[model samples]
Target: MNPPADADSPARQIDARIAALGDWRGETLARMRALVHEAGPEVIETVKWGGVPVWEHAGILCTGETYKAVVKLTFARGAALDDPTGLFNASLEGNTRRAIDIREGETPDADAFKALVRAAAALNASKRKPARR
Candidate 1:
Protein backbone atom coordinates (compact mmCIF):
# COMPACT_ATOMS: atom_id res chain seq x y z
CA MET A 1 0.00 0.00 0.00
CA ASN A 2 1.12 3.56 -0.67
CA PRO A 3 2.14 5.82 2.15
CA PRO A 4 -0.30 8.41 3.40
CA ALA A 5 -0.14 11.83 1.77
CA ASP A 6 1.48 14.67 3.68
CA ALA A 7 -0.88 16.64 5.88
CA ASP A 8 -0.86 20.00 4.16
CA SER A 9 -2.27 23.20 5.58
CA PRO A 10 -5.49 24.47 4.08
CA ALA A 11 -3.72 27.08 1.91
CA ARG A 12 -1.17 24.53 0.78
CA GLN A 13 -3.94 22.05 0.13
CA ILE A 14 -5.60 24.63 -2.09
CA ASP A 15 -2.26 25.16 -3.82
CA ALA A 16 -1.87 21.44 -4.33
CA ARG A 17 -5.34 21.21 -5.85
CA ILE A 18 -4.55 23.93 -8.35
CA ALA A 19 -1.21 22.38 -9.22
CA ALA A 20 -2.64 18.90 -9.53
CA LEU A 21 -5.28 20.07 -11.98
CA GLY A 22 -2.41 21.22 -14.28
CA ASP A 23 -4.79 22.45 -17.00
CA TRP A 24 -7.06 25.32 -17.90
CA ARG A 25 -9.04 24.48 -14.81
CA GLY A 26 -5.93 25.07 -12.73
CA GLU A 27 -5.27 28.36 -14.47
CA THR A 28 -8.84 29.46 -13.99
CA LEU A 29 -8.86 28.48 -10.32
CA ALA A 30 -5.60 30.32 -9.78
CA ARG A 31 -6.96 33.40 -11.50
CA MET A 32 -10.12 33.24 -9.44
CA ARG A 33 -8.13 32.98 -6.20
CA ALA A 34 -6.06 36.00 -7.15
CA LEU A 35 -9.16 38.02 -7.90
CA VAL A 36 -10.67 37.08 -4.58
CA HIS A 37 -7.57 38.32 -2.77
CA GLU A 38 -7.31 41.49 -4.82
CA ALA A 39 -10.97 42.25 -4.38
CA GLY A 40 -11.07 41.50 -0.67
CA PRO A 41 -7.68 41.48 0.95
CA GLU A 42 -9.21 41.03 4.37
CA VAL A 43 -10.84 37.76 3.41
CA ILE A 44 -9.18 34.56 4.58
CA GLU A 45 -9.02 31.37 2.53
CA THR A 46 -10.13 28.02 3.89
CA VAL A 47 -10.63 24.49 2.65
CA LYS A 48 -14.06 22.91 2.93
CA TRP A 49 -16.29 20.16 1.51
CA GLY A 50 -13.37 17.78 1.19
CA GLY A 51 -11.08 20.31 -0.57
CA VAL A 52 -13.02 23.20 -2.05
CA PRO A 53 -11.48 26.65 -1.49
CA VAL A 54 -13.64 29.07 0.48
CA TRP A 55 -13.03 32.78 1.00
CA GLU A 56 -14.36 34.40 4.13
CA HIS A 57 -14.29 37.84 5.68
CA ALA A 58 -17.02 38.44 8.24
CA GLY A 59 -18.54 35.21 6.98
CA ILE A 60 -18.35 33.00 3.91
CA LEU A 61 -17.89 35.12 0.83
CA CYS A 62 -17.70 32.42 -1.82
CA THR A 63 -16.41 28.98 -2.69
CA GLY A 64 -14.20 27.72 -5.54
CA GLU A 65 -15.49 24.50 -6.96
CA THR A 66 -13.56 23.01 -9.85
CA TYR A 67 -15.08 20.45 -12.16
CA LYS A 68 -14.03 18.76 -15.39
CA ALA A 69 -15.62 21.29 -17.73
CA VAL A 70 -15.84 24.44 -15.64
CA VAL A 71 -14.74 26.20 -12.46
CA LYS A 72 -17.71 27.49 -10.51
CA LEU A 73 -17.42 30.40 -8.07
CA THR A 74 -20.44 30.40 -5.79
CA PHE A 75 -21.00 33.51 -3.72
CA ALA A 76 -22.72 32.69 -0.42
CA ARG A 77 -24.85 35.80 -0.33
CA GLY A 78 -24.90 36.28 -4.07
CA ALA A 79 -28.62 36.51 -4.53
CA ALA A 80 -28.64 39.51 -2.21
CA LEU A 81 -25.93 41.36 -4.15
CA ASP A 82 -26.36 43.41 -7.34
CA ASP A 83 -25.01 42.17 -10.64
CA PRO A 84 -25.11 45.05 -13.08
CA THR A 85 -22.66 43.31 -15.39
CA GLY A 86 -24.73 40.15 -15.41
CA LEU A 87 -21.83 38.02 -14.24
CA PHE A 88 -24.05 35.48 -12.52
CA ASN A 89 -25.38 32.89 -14.90
CA ALA A 90 -25.68 29.51 -13.23
CA SER A 91 -27.53 28.79 -9.98
CA LEU A 92 -29.93 31.61 -10.71
CA GLU A 93 -32.95 29.73 -9.42
CA GLY A 94 -31.46 29.63 -5.92
CA ASN A 95 -32.56 32.28 -3.45
CA THR A 96 -29.32 32.58 -1.44
CA ARG A 97 -26.51 31.47 -3.73
CA ARG A 98 -25.40 32.58 -7.18
CA ALA A 99 -22.60 31.15 -9.24
CA ILE A 100 -20.42 32.18 -12.14
CA ASP A 101 -19.40 29.22 -14.21
CA ILE A 102 -16.21 29.70 -16.21
CA ARG A 103 -15.46 27.20 -18.90
CA GLU A 104 -12.35 26.62 -21.00
CA GLY A 105 -11.39 29.57 -23.25
CA GLU A 106 -13.54 31.94 -21.22
CA THR A 107 -12.37 34.75 -18.94
CA PRO A 108 -14.37 36.61 -16.34
CA ASP A 109 -14.40 40.40 -16.23
CA ALA A 110 -11.99 41.13 -13.39
CA ASP A 111 -13.55 44.42 -12.36
CA ALA A 112 -17.06 43.08 -12.19
CA PHE A 113 -15.97 40.02 -10.25
CA LYS A 114 -14.03 42.17 -7.82
CA ALA A 115 -17.11 44.30 -7.33
CA LEU A 116 -19.11 41.26 -6.39
CA VAL A 117 -16.43 40.18 -3.94
CA ARG A 118 -16.43 43.61 -2.30
CA ALA A 119 -20.20 43.65 -2.12
CA ALA A 120 -20.25 40.23 -0.51
CA ALA A 121 -17.68 41.37 2.04
CA ALA A 122 -19.69 44.50 2.77
CA LEU A 123 -22.86 42.46 3.18
CA ASN A 124 -21.13 40.18 5.65
CA ALA A 125 -19.71 43.07 7.64
CA SER A 126 -23.11 44.74 7.82
CA LYS A 127 -24.57 41.69 9.47
CA ARG A 128 -21.89 41.56 12.21
CA LYS A 129 -22.41 43.27 15.53
CA PRO A 130 -19.75 45.50 17.06
CA ALA A 131 -17.66 43.91 19.81
CA ARG A 132 -18.69 44.86 23.32
CA ARG A 133 -16.02 46.15 25.62
Candidate 2:
Protein backbone atom coordinates (compact mmCIF):
# COMPACT_ATOMS: atom_id res chain seq x y z
CA MET A 1 0.00 0.00 0.00
CA ASN A 2 1.10 3.58 -0.54
CA PRO A 3 2.65 5.31 2.41
CA PRO A 4 0.41 7.73 4.24
CA ALA A 5 0.65 11.34 3.17
CA ASP A 6 2.75 13.54 5.42
CA ALA A 7 1.13 16.36 7.38
CA ASP A 8 2.41 18.91 4.90
CA SER A 9 1.59 16.87 1.83
CA PRO A 10 -2.01 17.92 1.68
CA ALA A 11 -1.04 21.55 1.34
CA ARG A 12 1.38 20.67 -1.43
CA GLN A 13 -1.20 18.56 -3.19
CA ILE A 14 -3.70 21.35 -2.95
CA ASP A 15 -1.17 23.72 -4.47
CA ALA A 16 -0.65 21.30 -7.32
CA ARG A 17 -4.37 20.94 -7.81
CA ILE A 18 -4.77 24.69 -8.02
CA ALA A 19 -1.90 24.94 -10.44
CA ALA A 20 -3.31 22.15 -12.59
CA LEU A 21 -6.65 23.89 -12.79
CA GLY A 22 -4.86 26.97 -14.20
CA ASP A 23 -7.97 29.06 -14.75
CA TRP A 24 -10.53 31.17 -12.99
CA ARG A 25 -11.55 28.09 -11.01
CA GLY A 26 -8.00 27.77 -9.68
CA GLU A 27 -7.83 31.46 -8.85
CA THR A 28 -11.19 31.34 -7.10
CA LEU A 29 -10.31 28.26 -5.05
CA ALA A 30 -6.94 29.76 -4.12
CA ARG A 31 -8.59 32.97 -2.96
CA MET A 32 -11.13 31.09 -0.87
CA ARG A 33 -8.39 28.96 0.65
CA ALA A 34 -6.47 32.06 1.66
CA LEU A 35 -9.59 33.55 3.21
CA VAL A 36 -10.22 30.42 5.23
CA HIS A 37 -6.67 30.51 6.56
CA GLU A 38 -6.94 34.18 7.38
CA ALA A 39 -10.16 33.60 9.28
CA GLY A 40 -8.78 30.62 11.23
CA PRO A 41 -5.03 30.48 11.52
CA GLU A 42 -5.35 27.18 13.38
CA VAL A 43 -7.32 25.59 10.58
CA ILE A 44 -6.08 22.28 9.13
CA GLU A 45 -5.94 21.50 5.43
CA THR A 46 -6.51 18.07 3.94
CA VAL A 47 -7.38 16.43 0.68
CA LYS A 48 -10.33 14.10 0.81
CA TRP A 49 -12.99 12.41 -1.37
CA GLY A 50 -10.69 12.09 -4.35
CA GLY A 51 -9.21 15.59 -4.41
CA VAL A 52 -11.44 18.04 -2.59
CA PRO A 53 -9.61 20.60 -0.47
CA VAL A 54 -11.02 20.51 3.04
CA TRP A 55 -10.41 22.92 5.88
CA GLU A 56 -11.00 21.98 9.49
CA HIS A 57 -10.55 23.32 12.97
CA ALA A 58 -11.65 20.83 15.61
CA GLY A 59 -13.88 19.58 12.81
CA ILE A 60 -14.57 20.36 9.16
CA LEU A 61 -15.13 24.02 8.42
CA CYS A 62 -15.74 23.64 4.70
CA THR A 63 -14.79 22.10 1.37
CA GLY A 64 -13.84 23.87 -1.84
CA GLU A 65 -15.16 22.29 -4.99
CA THR A 66 -14.49 23.51 -8.51
CA TYR A 67 -16.67 23.13 -11.59
CA LYS A 68 -16.76 24.35 -15.13
CA ALA A 69 -18.86 27.38 -14.32
CA VAL A 70 -18.54 27.81 -10.58
CA VAL A 71 -16.31 27.38 -7.57
CA LYS A 72 -18.38 26.26 -4.57
CA LEU A 73 -17.57 26.61 -0.91
CA THR A 74 -19.70 24.29 1.23
CA PHE A 75 -19.72 24.68 4.99
CA ALA A 76 -19.95 21.58 7.17
CA ARG A 77 -22.50 22.92 9.64
CA GLY A 78 -23.72 25.94 7.76
CA ALA A 79 -27.39 25.59 8.55
CA ALA A 80 -26.60 26.21 12.22
CA LEU A 81 -24.58 29.36 11.53
CA ASP A 82 -26.07 32.83 11.30
CA ASP A 83 -25.49 34.45 7.92
CA PRO A 84 -26.62 38.04 8.29
CA THR A 85 -24.91 38.91 5.03
CA GLY A 86 -26.81 36.22 3.15
CA LEU A 87 -23.71 34.76 1.53
CA PHE A 88 -25.21 31.33 1.14
CA ASN A 89 -27.01 30.97 -2.17
CA ALA A 90 -26.85 27.23 -2.78
CA SER A 91 -27.61 24.03 -0.95
CA LEU A 92 -30.27 25.87 1.04
CA GLU A 93 -32.56 22.83 0.99
CA GLY A 94 -30.05 20.82 3.01
CA ASN A 95 -30.50 20.53 6.75
CA THR A 96 -26.84 20.55 7.81
CA ARG A 97 -24.96 22.18 4.97
CA ARG A 98 -25.01 25.45 3.04
CA ALA A 99 -22.95 26.55 0.06
CA ILE A 100 -21.85 29.71 -1.70
CA ASP A 101 -21.55 29.29 -5.41
CA ILE A 102 -19.21 31.76 -7.15
CA ARG A 103 -19.66 31.94 -10.86
CA GLU A 104 -17.27 33.27 -13.46
CA GLY A 105 -16.76 37.04 -13.30
CA GLU A 106 -18.52 37.10 -9.92
CA THR A 107 -16.87 38.08 -6.67
CA PRO A 108 -17.87 37.01 -3.18
CA ASP A 109 -17.95 39.44 -0.29
CA ALA A 110 -14.57 38.86 1.34
CA ASP A 111 -15.44 40.32 4.70
CA ALA A 112 -18.68 38.41 5.00
CA PHE A 113 -17.07 35.22 3.80
CA LYS A 114 -14.28 35.55 6.35
CA ALA A 115 -16.83 36.08 9.08
CA LEU A 116 -18.62 32.93 7.99
CA VAL A 117 -15.36 30.99 8.11
CA ARG A 118 -14.59 32.20 11.60
CA ALA A 119 -18.10 31.30 12.72
CA ALA A 120 -17.84 27.84 11.24
CA ALA A 121 -14.54 27.25 13.01
CA ALA A 122 -16.08 28.33 16.30
CA LEU A 123 -19.06 26.05 15.79
CA ASN A 124 -16.76 23.10 15.11
CA ALA A 125 -14.76 23.84 18.25
CA SER A 126 -17.93 24.01 20.29
CA LYS A 127 -18.94 20.55 19.11
CA ARG A 128 -15.56 18.96 19.76
CA LYS A 129 -15.50 15.80 21.85
CA PRO A 130 -13.89 15.98 25.24
CA ALA A 131 -10.46 14.45 25.73
CA ARG A 132 -10.39 11.02 27.33
CA ARG A 133 -8.26 10.53 30.43
Candidate 3:
Protein backbone atom coordinates (compact mmCIF):
# COMPACT_ATOMS: atom_id res chain seq x y z
CA MET A 1 0.00 0.00 0.00
CA ASN A 2 1.06 3.58 -0.73
CA PRO A 3 0.94 6.62 1.54
CA PRO A 4 -1.25 9.62 0.80
CA ALA A 5 0.36 12.43 -1.19
CA ASP A 6 1.52 15.46 0.70
CA ALA A 7 -0.51 18.63 0.62
CA ASP A 8 -0.18 21.77 -1.53
CA SER A 9 3.05 22.86 -3.26
CA PRO A 10 6.22 21.01 -4.04
CA ALA A 11 8.03 22.76 -1.24
CA ARG A 12 5.41 21.54 1.16
CA GLN A 13 5.75 18.04 -0.15
CA ILE A 14 9.49 18.17 0.40
CA ASP A 15 9.00 19.54 3.87
CA ALA A 16 6.67 16.71 4.67
CA ARG A 17 9.20 14.21 3.41
CA ILE A 18 11.88 15.69 5.60
CA ALA A 19 9.57 15.70 8.57
CA ALA A 20 8.58 12.15 7.92
CA LEU A 21 12.15 10.93 7.80
CA GLY A 22 12.63 12.06 11.45
CA ASP A 23 16.31 11.18 11.42
CA TRP A 24 19.75 12.18 10.19
CA ARG A 25 18.65 11.72 6.60
CA GLY A 26 16.01 14.42 7.07
CA GLU A 27 18.52 16.89 8.45
CA THR A 28 21.01 16.10 5.69
CA LEU A 29 18.45 16.53 2.95
CA ALA A 30 17.29 19.79 4.47
CA ARG A 31 20.81 21.15 4.67
CA MET A 32 21.63 20.14 1.11
CA ARG A 33 18.38 21.65 -0.12
CA ALA A 34 19.34 24.90 1.56
CA LEU A 35 22.68 24.85 -0.22
CA VAL A 36 21.01 24.26 -3.55
CA HIS A 37 18.79 27.28 -2.92
CA GLU A 38 21.69 29.46 -1.84
CA ALA A 39 23.64 28.55 -4.97
CA GLY A 40 20.70 29.02 -7.32
CA PRO A 41 17.94 31.10 -5.82
CA GLU A 42 15.90 30.94 -9.01
CA VAL A 43 15.66 27.19 -8.94
CA ILE A 44 12.26 25.51 -8.86
CA GLU A 45 11.95 22.67 -6.38
CA THR A 46 9.85 19.65 -7.22
CA VAL A 47 9.06 16.16 -5.98
CA LYS A 48 9.52 13.60 -8.69
CA TRP A 49 9.38 9.79 -8.90
CA GLY A 50 7.57 9.37 -5.62
CA GLY A 51 8.82 12.16 -3.35
CA VAL A 52 12.42 12.58 -4.46
CA PRO A 53 13.38 16.25 -4.16
CA VAL A 54 14.52 17.65 -7.49
CA TRP A 55 15.90 21.12 -7.91
CA GLU A 56 15.70 22.70 -11.36
CA HIS A 57 16.68 25.93 -13.02
CA ALA A 58 16.82 25.83 -16.82
CA GLY A 59 16.78 22.07 -16.35
CA ILE A 60 17.27 19.44 -13.67
CA LEU A 61 20.20 20.33 -11.40
CA CYS A 62 20.12 17.54 -8.87
CA THR A 63 17.94 15.22 -6.82
CA GLY A 64 17.89 14.61 -3.06
CA GLU A 65 17.17 10.97 -2.45
CA THR A 66 17.00 9.57 1.07
CA TYR A 67 18.00 5.94 1.54
CA LYS A 68 18.49 3.70 4.57
CA ALA A 69 22.17 4.45 5.00
CA VAL A 70 22.93 7.50 2.90
CA VAL A 71 21.36 10.63 1.54
CA LYS A 72 22.34 10.70 -2.13
CA LEU A 73 22.41 13.84 -4.23
CA THR A 74 22.36 12.94 -7.90
CA PHE A 75 23.23 15.47 -10.56
CA ALA A 76 21.68 14.98 -13.96
CA ARG A 77 24.65 16.28 -15.97
CA GLY A 78 27.31 15.89 -13.32
CA ALA A 79 29.66 14.00 -15.66
CA ALA A 80 30.26 17.25 -17.59
CA LEU A 81 31.14 19.36 -14.59
CA ASP A 82 34.58 19.53 -13.00
CA ASP A 83 35.01 18.24 -9.45
CA PRO A 84 38.12 19.75 -7.93
CA THR A 85 36.89 19.07 -4.40
CA GLY A 86 36.05 15.45 -5.10
CA LEU A 87 32.53 15.92 -3.81
CA PHE A 88 31.07 13.26 -6.05
CA ASN A 89 31.85 9.76 -4.85
CA ALA A 90 29.00 7.55 -6.04
CA SER A 91 27.49 6.67 -9.38
CA LEU A 92 30.87 7.39 -10.97
CA GLU A 93 30.44 4.63 -13.52
CA GLY A 94 27.67 6.52 -15.30
CA ASN A 95 28.44 8.76 -18.24
CA THR A 96 25.66 11.29 -17.56
CA ARG A 97 24.79 11.20 -13.87
CA ARG A 98 26.98 11.64 -10.80
CA ALA A 99 26.06 11.34 -7.14
CA ILE A 100 27.38 12.22 -3.71
CA ASP A 101 26.48 9.77 -1.03
CA ILE A 102 26.46 11.33 2.43
CA ARG A 103 26.34 8.80 5.21
CA GLU A 104 25.39 9.23 8.84
CA GLY A 105 27.95 11.16 10.93
CA GLU A 106 29.59 12.35 7.70
CA THR A 107 29.73 15.95 6.62
CA PRO A 108 29.89 17.36 3.12
CA ASP A 109 31.87 20.48 2.29
CA ALA A 110 29.09 23.06 1.93
CA ASP A 111 30.92 25.63 -0.20
CA ALA A 112 32.09 23.10 -2.76
CA PHE A 113 28.65 21.59 -2.93
CA LYS A 114 27.11 24.97 -3.64
CA ALA A 115 29.68 25.54 -6.36
CA LEU A 116 28.63 22.32 -8.05
CA VAL A 117 25.01 23.38 -7.77
CA ARG A 118 25.80 26.65 -9.49
CA ALA A 119 27.81 24.88 -12.16
CA ALA A 120 24.93 22.53 -12.88
CA ALA A 121 22.57 25.48 -13.17
CA ALA A 122 24.98 27.22 -15.51
CA LEU A 123 25.25 24.12 -17.66
CA ASN A 124 21.49 23.92 -17.91
CA ALA A 125 21.25 27.60 -18.79
CA SER A 126 23.86 27.22 -21.53
CA LYS A 127 21.80 24.53 -23.17
CA ARG A 128 18.79 26.86 -23.38
CA LYS A 129 20.79 29.69 -24.95
CA PRO A 130 20.04 30.46 -28.58
CA ALA A 131 22.36 29.07 -31.23
CA ARG A 132 24.54 31.53 -33.16
CA ARG A 133 23.74 32.21 -36.80
Candidate 4:
Protein backbone atom coordinates (compact mmCIF):
# COMPACT_ATOMS: atom_id res chain seq x y z
CA MET A 1 0.00 0.00 0.00
CA ASN A 2 1.22 3.50 -0.77
CA PRO A 3 2.24 5.43 2.30
CA PRO A 4 0.26 8.47 3.37
CA ALA A 5 1.50 11.86 2.28
CA ASP A 6 3.62 13.72 4.82
CA ALA A 7 1.27 15.63 7.08
CA ASP A 8 3.94 18.09 8.24
CA SER A 9 4.41 21.28 6.34
CA PRO A 10 7.39 21.69 4.03
CA ALA A 11 9.41 23.59 6.60
CA ARG A 12 8.64 21.04 9.26
CA GLN A 13 9.49 18.16 6.96
CA ILE A 14 12.78 19.81 6.13
CA ASP A 15 13.51 20.30 9.81
CA ALA A 16 12.70 16.68 10.53
CA ARG A 17 14.85 15.49 7.62
CA ILE A 18 17.81 17.43 8.87
CA ALA A 19 17.33 16.24 12.41
CA ALA A 20 17.02 12.68 11.22
CA LEU A 21 20.28 12.92 9.34
CA GLY A 22 22.12 13.94 12.52
CA ASP A 23 25.43 14.19 10.72
CA TRP A 24 27.55 16.37 8.50
CA ARG A 25 25.14 15.92 5.60
CA GLY A 26 22.36 17.33 7.73
CA GLU A 27 24.50 20.24 8.82
CA THR A 28 25.49 21.05 5.26
CA LEU A 29 21.92 20.89 3.97
CA ALA A 30 20.74 23.14 6.78
CA ARG A 31 23.48 25.68 6.06
CA MET A 32 22.70 25.74 2.34
CA ARG A 33 18.98 26.07 3.09
CA ALA A 34 19.64 29.09 5.30
CA LEU A 35 21.73 30.69 2.58
CA VAL A 36 18.98 30.10 0.01
CA HIS A 37 16.47 31.80 2.29
CA GLU A 38 18.79 34.66 3.10
CA ALA A 39 19.47 35.28 -0.56
CA GLY A 40 15.81 35.14 -1.56
CA PRO A 41 13.48 36.03 1.26
CA GLU A 42 10.43 35.59 -0.97
CA VAL A 43 11.36 32.07 -1.96
CA ILE A 44 8.90 29.32 -1.00
CA GLU A 45 9.94 25.95 0.37
CA THR A 46 8.26 22.62 -0.34
CA VAL A 47 8.78 18.88 -0.55
CA LYS A 48 8.52 16.97 -3.81
CA TRP A 49 9.30 13.50 -5.22
CA GLY A 50 8.48 12.16 -1.78
CA GLY A 51 11.21 13.86 0.29
CA VAL A 52 13.33 16.16 -1.81
CA PRO A 53 13.44 19.72 -0.51
CA VAL A 54 12.45 22.25 -3.14
CA TRP A 55 12.80 26.02 -3.13
CA GLU A 56 10.92 28.26 -5.48
CA HIS A 57 10.17 31.86 -6.32
CA ALA A 58 8.33 32.59 -9.60
CA GLY A 59 9.30 29.01 -10.49
CA ILE A 60 11.33 26.19 -9.05
CA LEU A 61 14.77 27.42 -8.01
CA CYS A 62 16.42 24.23 -6.90
CA THR A 63 16.16 20.83 -5.25
CA GLY A 64 18.33 19.57 -2.41
CA GLU A 65 19.14 15.91 -2.92
CA THR A 66 21.24 14.14 -0.30
CA TYR A 67 23.33 11.11 -1.14
CA LYS A 68 25.81 8.87 0.57
CA ALA A 69 28.81 11.12 -0.17
CA VAL A 70 27.41 14.35 -1.50
CA VAL A 71 24.54 16.78 -1.18
CA LYS A 72 23.39 17.83 -4.63
CA LEU A 73 21.60 21.13 -5.23
CA THR A 74 20.12 21.01 -8.71
CA PHE A 75 18.97 24.29 -10.18
CA ALA A 76 16.04 23.87 -12.57
CA ARG A 77 17.05 26.59 -15.00
CA GLY A 78 20.73 26.38 -14.31
CA ALA A 79 21.78 26.25 -17.93
CA ALA A 80 20.09 29.59 -18.47
CA LEU A 81 21.77 31.31 -15.53
CA ASP A 82 25.31 32.59 -15.68
CA ASP A 83 27.74 30.86 -13.34
CA PRO A 84 30.47 33.44 -12.84
CA THR A 85 31.71 31.70 -9.69
CA GLY A 86 31.73 28.25 -11.31
CA LEU A 87 29.82 26.74 -8.39
CA PHE A 88 28.25 24.15 -10.65
CA ASN A 89 30.61 21.23 -10.65
CA ALA A 90 28.23 18.47 -11.64
CA SER A 91 25.53 17.75 -14.20
CA LEU A 92 27.45 19.92 -16.59
CA GLU A 93 26.54 17.79 -19.57
CA GLY A 94 22.85 18.34 -19.11
CA ASN A 95 21.11 20.78 -21.43
CA THR A 96 19.01 22.32 -18.66
CA ARG A 97 19.70 21.47 -15.03
CA ARG A 98 23.02 22.10 -13.31
CA ALA A 99 24.05 20.91 -9.90
CA ILE A 100 26.49 21.78 -7.15
CA ASP A 101 27.62 18.62 -5.47
CA ILE A 102 29.05 19.22 -2.03
CA ARG A 103 31.01 16.35 -0.61
CA GLU A 104 31.72 15.58 2.99
CA GLY A 105 34.27 17.95 4.53
CA GLU A 106 33.84 20.30 1.56
CA THR A 107 32.08 23.64 1.77
CA PRO A 108 30.71 25.84 -1.02
CA ASP A 109 31.58 29.54 -1.11
CA ALA A 110 28.71 31.23 0.68
CA ASP A 111 28.78 34.55 -1.13
CA ALA A 112 29.02 32.93 -4.53
CA PHE A 113 26.32 30.43 -3.72
CA LYS A 114 23.98 33.14 -2.51
CA ALA A 115 24.63 35.08 -5.66
CA LEU A 116 23.70 32.03 -7.70
CA VAL A 117 20.45 31.67 -5.79
CA ARG A 118 19.56 35.28 -6.45
CA ALA A 119 20.32 34.80 -10.11
CA ALA A 120 18.04 31.78 -10.28
CA ALA A 121 15.24 33.70 -8.59
CA ALA A 122 15.73 36.56 -11.00
CA LEU A 123 15.58 34.20 -13.95
CA ASN A 124 12.32 32.76 -12.68
CA ALA A 125 10.91 36.23 -12.23
CA SER A 126 11.87 37.19 -15.74
CA LYS A 127 10.06 34.23 -17.25
CA ARG A 128 6.78 35.13 -15.51
CA LYS A 129 4.03 36.31 -17.85
CA PRO A 130 2.57 39.72 -17.14
CA ALA A 131 -1.09 40.05 -16.16
CA ARG A 132 -3.61 40.88 -18.86
CA ARG A 133 -4.32 44.59 -18.94
In the range 1-133, model 1's lDDT, one tens digit per residue, is: 1213555766778888999999999999999999998998777888999999999999999999999899999999999999999999999998999999999999999999999999999999999999999
Provide TM-scores for the models: 0.92, 0.93, 0.91, 0.92
Off by over 4 Å in 4: 1-7
lDDT (Cα atoms) of all candidates against the true structure: 0.92, 0.91, 0.92, 0.93
Q: What is the Å distance of residue 46 in model 3 from its true position?
A: 0.8
TM-score of 4: 0.92
Better of 2 and 4 by TM-score: 2
Model 4 lDDT per residue over 10-90, tens place:
888888898899999999999999999999988899899989999999989999999999999999999998998899999
Compared to the true structure, candidate 3 yields what TM-score?
0.91
Candidate 3 C-alpha error for residue 102, in Å? 0.3
Best by TM-score: 2
Q: Record all residue pairs in model 1 with backbone atoms less than 3 Å apart, i.e. clashing.
A: none
User: Residues 81-103, candidate 2, lDDT per residue (tens digit)?
Assistant: 99999999999999999999999
Error of 3 at 79 (Å): 0.3
What is the per-residue lDDT of model 3 for residues 1-133, given as tens digits with 9 covering 90 to 100? 1224656778888889999999999999989998988888898998899889999999899999999999999999999999999999999999999999999999899999999999999999998977789
